[model samples]
Target: MIGNIFLFIFATGALILLNKFLAAWLPKRNPKEKYLSKAETLVFIIFLLIIAVTIESYDVNSSVSVFTIGIMVPRQGKTHRTLIQRLSYPIHEFVLPVYFGYMGFRFSITALTKRYYIGLVIIVILALAGKLIGVICACMYLKIPKKYWLFLPTILSVKGHVGVLLLDANYSKKKWWTTTIHDMMLASLVVTTLVSGVLASFLLKAREKDFAPQKTCLESHDTHEELRVLSCVYGVRHARGTISLISALSGCHGASKPFAALLMHLVPLPKKRKSSELLYHELGDDVHGDDEFGTNDGLEINDSIDSFAKDSKLLIQQVKLVTKMLNMHVEICNATEDLRISIVFLPFHKHQRIDGKTTNDGEIFRQMNRNVLRHAPCSVGIFVDRNITGFQQPHGFDSVQHVAALFFGGPDDREALALCRWLANNTLIHLTIIHFVSEDSQTESPVRNTTTQDNNDVFIEVAGRDQTEHEADRSFLEEFHNRFVTTGQVGFMEKRVSDGPHTLTILREIGEMYSLFVVGKSRGDSPMTVRMKDWEECPELGTVGDFLASSLDVNASVLVVQRQRHSHDNFLDD
Candidate 1:
């Protein structure tokens, strides 16, 4: 009892049409994430059953028929394939276990005697030995590291689910499989799966390294060394802002101070999609040029960044990654360590309206920023936007960027100054250093509190343990002042503030003059700023940045910088 061939064709065609329709209507981030709920899962299963009953020619297995349909359907576009996978996940989650359980029940344990058990064990051992031998020969030919041989075989030994389906199909055909032989094959499959899981756990434990918070910031890096930066953004618009910032950092391309950057654009992976996150060297195009990637994303970003890099005489590597928010921080940290990056620039996870107010807060993206700040392998900066992309290049004297760095004291503040130094190298940027000092404390001669570190690293400590580092503060500012202030491209000023309120007043007075404000996420708690609620709105911005990000009076953007956390992966700060 089966339907006509025409009906089968129509049902299959209908499924493909629906997938195409929804994919075109939805956004790239998958707005239909909840479309296939539990109720819809049953409807999907019922449709599959109807399709399954229509085809009498392939009566051996319904899943095999489904597979035939899957291979026939075209999966050319990445976003198109995303919708297909989203539609198919309900089958994998709810129907797969039931299918396996039904097949498992069909195997009769009472039919197996003690003699069959002995044969099954012998068969399993023989299969395991053969797999190990083949993997060893392949490893030798490939010249893989000896350390990987054990776990490598374990991974290869795990059989795929497709094989189980094929086995059931062959058994139904009554070709070579007897009842005893089929049961033994199923038992061996289960045994090998368990063994591989156990072996992999023990062998890979030593290789698993916990992510410790790092302190790999520019403050510790030698000033003469070539600076390396990893600039990350969420979309094309954000990419534009990063390119402008990188241009500011890429100043004049003098041989005396070289610079390198990697621009990474992140695309969110649709839920339940099994595609591995890919990091390609060039975005939007494979070697063939105009592949199924379809050039829908990042092409504009790549071209703009490439043109700027070429004009500036700097080599910028552009890359894009499709991944879930859960693993983005890990990928960022790993990339930082591999590239030996000095710092990472991240855009804040909010959109700015025309009135200079921030809205449409993306909490998931905010969490991503938090994780990166907590575990980044290098220094991390969150760039707040107030027309950051519209920041005109330093074309001439008339069109210049007014940049200011707020310095209190600490590793992070020093990092902000170091970055400002990079920005000031451009003749078009006017750099201003604003120092906040306590009203009672007087400016005295420098005290000797310099601490030398191994391998050209240095940590500055003031004479007093409880107060901010006054000596280190002056040393860094003096060097910056002597070099740039004389050139008229830089300005140095000090404001005596009694408390946090007074400090806010100073910021309010000077905030309107600057187009960009650079501040550290954390600084020494002096009497002037210790009372400011850094933890109120967003703790990740520290004291000054939190205020600047939320302020409606000032139209300037903010960059909140943090030095890399020290190496303590096992114990992360809450």
Candidate 2:
């Protein structure tokens, strides 16, 4: 029996190791990742079959080898990892249900007698209390916030699939425990898991009110104060463009109070069973050497900090080289709530591939953007890089960097103009404000016309008022032009493109002339925007910004800005 058990263990271990070796080898052996992913999937299935055979032949009581082999498989790259996740979706959705259902069938409810009921209640209470107490104690020792005390305990108490597997293993071994005790434990597992899930849901709903501050941060910000901006970059490739935008917004051109920039490097969490601490420790000896601005508070510390620490160590070395040359005071850290900043800058997910076709990194980046937008403490800007290699001059230099700002009159446009106002301070940057006035703004609607003279007088008065409002808009633009458009510093250009096709043509022509394009996100009932809406591929880039960023002929990097929604009341005055 002992020899058979050893043989089973040896065979399964060998197959798992072989599977890992092949997975690593196949990718190198084949250039096409699609073919390699298929080959890796086949190898995984073969190892699982071999483990099953070993278990049957040796008459092993547990199927723990299945779980062990899964953990043993190495994730090679994003393509390989994504393929594995896609392949396992069916098993997780369909097969797990059958397996768990079969386990449920073996559970005998009749075994729960009065005597066993007492033990079952005791087991459930103890399981809940023990798990909750242990996690709460750990959280307290770590100085975690009190708001998360109940939430962490509730989530940690969830037994989930592992609990089912353990119970099934015990039930398979008939003599492992007495029948009544085994049945009671299984019932307790079900009860505690359900209770924990309910508690977690309740805690999450109750915590929603605490997030109110995120909405208020932008509204309360004073534009006259030193601008505090938090810029988030996913990789080193995006660092240059993000820093450029920050430099432009920072008013880095000999300003008395320059912008304070906090560079937040974002990274996806590591795969399952991987220790983030180990990853950080292996990064280098000088991991925490430059983290002067980062805090040691345990409340904000989590697994993400390890990734942040690792990425920050790498990013600081690169960012410092640029920030130092620019003479900017920049702090590098992970994107977290510990630091409060007014504006957050994020890079667009899509990147131009070797074949010239654009591809996004993955849904992870898109989801990250959505989360930031949903809960960001202030205004956010998503920068789409078109690899504009034309304007490589250092920001605030005397060399001309032409910037085009698209304005159509909305809160977003106002915000974009405000940002340009800051950029206009630099003597090197020549700013062009392209004001697009749609045909709808010039014409009054006939829908409200009436035959009565009194009604006609009222309608005429309203039409006159509408014309006066249009004049006010023009007056505002004139004031803007008078303020910025001095001799050779700023230029104001107006385009009266009525239809969408005409607007696109005008934008295409204007886009070719500029090194950078800044545009608002909202269209504000503009007829030109309505006409161009059909051509919008990515609405997240807004209309004009998307057209410029996606157009091959544009040749300009785009900055799409959206003002915080709650700040419209305060910002409209500007």
Candidate 3:
């Protein structure tokens, strides 16, 4: 018997090593492969099943071998893990119910008695007490906030599927165990799962009332204070570009007033109802990890953030380094509605792959952007980074950072200009304002401009509403120029384009010269924008911004700004 035990142990260890080898080797050999093909995954599943059966044939527990193999499967990246999880989901959902039913069939309902019921109650009480006590102690030791104390313990006490598996394995191995014990164990599992779920739901609902207040504007009480920005990072790939953009906006290069950023890392919730707590716990741990503020230069660090495609730690660390070096205060948290922030920045979802085709997981990210735009209290900026991995100081460290704002006479354009004004305070930063006007609007009859009298004129003509709007825009622009641009602090230029094609050509030529382009989303139904409508892929990025984003060769990063809807009325008087 001892020799047989040794043989089983050796076999199990060898199989685990083999599984690990395959999981690591296969991905390394095919670096470009996002996931195992269906046929390949099928073969892997068959091989693991065969091993389980072989272990069972030898009078050894097959569950351990199967569980080990499952755990050994390495999730190399987000795309890889997503494919694997999605492919395995149907199989698990279909088989779990059948497996549970078979297990239930082995026990008789008639076995339930008063004595067994008493024993079951005692078991549940002890389990709940032990889990709660342990969790409470850990939370206290770690200095976790008191609000999560009860919720964490209650949720952690829930054990269903794993318990069922362990009971089934034990019953198979020890056939002599009585039916009453099995029934009681099953009953306990059900009660624990249901109780924990209910408690969790109640806690979440209660916590909703304690949300943070909303921020309606970016303007600080003191005009000289720092601008607070809330930047959202979806994954590690976009982290570098997002940080670079934040650095520029923060005016890190010798500015009197710097920007403070709340780096809200976005983590998608799992499909399961109780998965939210798991995400919260994971993020909490990440925040508490060593070097929470440590600077990491490499982008390939091994900081995993809730089973996503890549290690978000590397991204977070890089963001920390940039923010730290810039002397900015950076706080990390999961994205939520209660955040008191102005100007939410989101990274564009789709990216150019090695094959030159733009691809992403799907519309989930786009929907996130839309939701944030609809509900964000202040202005929102969606950044489309085209291969821009952080900013490089062109001519040593003293060189000026070229930033251009493409103004097209709208509230959104004005918001973009406002952001540029803050950025221009840095002496090392050069801001260029390019105001695009239609050729027709620019060459309007001079007689029309002089006839508009403010004093009471008896013969009032209600025509030329467009001209009045044009004059209003010109008035606002002149005031903006005199206050911000005319001091020789920034460069300003105006370009009149005949049509959409002409506008696109000029933007493309000039955009290549700058490091970043800031454009508005609402480019009022002008003929120029109307003609360029066919080329727009993402309408969220207005006509010019979308065109710039879609170009494969364009190296400049784009920030598509949209002002809050309520603020628009204040900017554009009837």
lDDT of each: 0.69, 0.61, 0.62
- Cα lDDT tens digits for candidate 3, 245-350: 6556655444456355555544443344333345655666445332343223111222232121232111221123223211111122122233445577888877
lDDT of 1 at 71: 62
Instruction: Judge candidate 2 against the unseen true structure and give its global Cα lDDT, from 0 to 1.
Output: 0.61
Backbone collision count in every prediction?
A: 6, 0, 1
What tens digits encode model 1's per-residue C-alpha lDDT throughout 19-45?
455333442344324223344434444
- Give the better candidate number (1 or 3) by TM-score: 1
Best by TM-score: 1
Runs of candidate 1 exceeding 4 Å displacement: 1-215, 253-256, 274-295, 388-390, 443-468, 486-489, 568-574
Residue 406 lDDT (model 1): 90
**Order of candidate numbers by lDDT, starting with the best:** 1, 3, 2
TM-score of each: 0.55, 0.47, 0.48
TM-score for predicted model 1 compared with the true structure: 0.55
lDDT of 2 by residue, 1-574 (tens): 8887787778778877887677556655544332345655666677688678657665565467777777776533322443454667787889898987887887899988888888888888898888878988998897776778888878876756877777655344567577667778888999999899999888878896553244333323444555667776655556556655655665534556435666654443333433446676686743543332222221122122223323322111112111221112112212323354566777787875555567878766665565555444356677776554433334335556788888776666666776777677765677887766554343532213232432112211111224554554455555566667634467665556556688788877766788888887766455676667777877777777778778877777778887765332233242
